[model samples]
Target: MTIDGSHAEGLGEVEFDDEKHAEDRQFVRALARGLEILRCFQPQEPLLGNRELAHRTGLPKPTVSRLTHTLVAMGLLEFLPNHEKYRLRSSVLALGYAAAATSGIVELARPIMQRVVDEHGGSFALGVRDRLSMICLIHCHSKAIFTLRMDVGSHVPMLPSAMGRGFLVGLPDHERQFLVDRLARVSRRGGQTTQEIVQRAIDEFKAQGFCASYGEWLHDILSIGAPVISHDRQVVLGLTYSAFSYATARATMNEVMGPQVRQVAAVIGDEITRLRWRP
Candidate 1:
């Protein structure tokens, strides 16, 4: 992932299919195909027919039909009568909601996130990497008039998102390299895929304590984030402070918002440490 300039870079992932893991007896092809079918439905393009599902998931039509039928019967997907398409049902939402509701990070970070929102006038996001996407667990939309439409469960591109960069930088060295290699493979940014380009952002994180992206994910958007490290669980929570580029310059966000977010993240990490390691 490469964010423009010294600011940073990235977005990327791959899934393991049954064939890849078929040697293991526990590998379930049906379950994998069913889940893959669900993931094919994008939030932007919510409705898709069986053929489209088959095309997107690379599963055969018959397999997709069977999976969709099972999913619809299970209430995880809804069949559209007129369109002959299927949309993910609220049951799918329940899965993400349940996870977010149960997360100790959201519980501990909400107040500070709100404070960041109030002060910064942009948005504060607490997220974790799911493959090459940063799945926002908590998004504190600022009270300021200027705000981005985002909330819990929003998926931001990993390489381009500040939260993603912070998460990448926060990863253990070998783990970071492994993920970076994955990003390199999936990257389609016209030959901008190189470890050297991404290393600048990591160097920035080492020097500034936060990583940033200026117009990498979305045009005219700027974000700075740091990783929340818990002393006990080896947890690295990705948190971001972000806004439109017109109002908050890259350097300003890096110098000011970065530190503020890092501090708030530290508080959350401390709380987690206290909760998990309390004697």
Candidate 2:
């Protein structure tokens, strides 16, 4: 699969590469289509109709209808007679929870991340790349009244957010290039080219061991992030510390929180290695 573009909520347009899998005898197009249909649902938009699902997945309405019916029958989606739309059911959440439970990283990092939030006055998060976005796997916040409200499962734009940049820099060279090429196709925002923005992130990471975003992802948010990689280089995640821009200064993030978050990321990586958590 490849990402074509993204919605305002950072859900990427999932495009199945037919030509690449055409010669594979084990490829199941129907199964792929069904999963793609499930992926169409996002946190910001819980209810979706066949027309919207068709648009998001680039599938025919008839196929979407069949898939939705099958998904409803399988208890993955709930049909609403009042609105002629479907909402994700408990089964989907169950699946996500089961997948998350298999990973020890969240459990291992929870106390450590919470301690940061306890000492500092911001939010700390761990995220993984999901297409052209970063999906929060874990989040902790301070008691501040104005802390960022994002929690687990929140999606942030990959090309703009500090967390996303941290994840991007953790990827292998070929994988990073592939994603950058796809991101280049997205429309420019803030009058900055994608390459230019990504280059700045790379340079910042190289110079300071962390990436910083000041009023870039959101006009009122300031953040610093670092990448976490497993010992074998198979698992990559992003760690971030963020606060409202009005409460935090850019220089503080660059000089203090940047290195602090970088150290946290390294500690999490070491814990993952010690525990031998492969997931």
The per-prediction CA RMSD against the true structure, in angstroms, equals 4.5, 3.6
TM-scores of all candidate predictions against the true structure:
0.87, 0.93
Evaluate residue 23 in candidate 2 and report its C-alpha lDDT on the 0 to 100 scale.
98
User: Compared to the true structure, candidate 1 yields what TM-score?
Assistant: 0.87
Write down the lDDT of every candidate, Cα atoms only. Answer: 0.75, 0.83
Task: Identify the candidate with maximal TM-score.
Answer: 2
Model 2 CA deviation exceeding 4 Å by range:
1-10
RMSD of 2: 3.6
